[model samples]
Target: MYPLDEAARAIVPNLRGAIDIPNCGHWTQQEHPELVNTALLEFLKGL
Candidate 1:
């Protein structure tokens, strides 16, 4: 979902606080509900 220049920000161990969903596109929450939900759950748990 990131622009080409910003794509590299999706990599792991980077300072950017983003979760990279493999093979995911623009409709990430819709197309990858399980992955999104899992990430959300984990994030919420930390709060």
Candidate 2:
């Protein structure tokens, strides 16, 4: 609902990061499923 990149960058600690899906709004997963899935997979793989 908000600008999560800036907020997450501020509060999510050093090891974590945020993604800003360009041309998308609040419903990122719905609007950009492939991009979101790719990001999620990459993040999960790192874990």
Best by lDDT: 2
Which residue ranges in model 1 land beyond 4 Å of their true spot?
Answer: 1-16
Query: What TM-score does each of the candidates earn?
Result: 0.61, 0.68
Candidate 2: lDDT of 3? 65
Query: On residues 1-47, what C-alpha lDDT tens digit does candidate 2 reach at each position?
Result: 34676667677666367676678998998999999999999999999
Q: Give the per-residue lDDT of model 1 (tens digit) for 1-47.
A: 44443656555545335677788899999999999899889888877
lDDT of 1 at 28: 98
So what's the TM-score on candidate 2?
0.68
TM-score of 1: 0.61
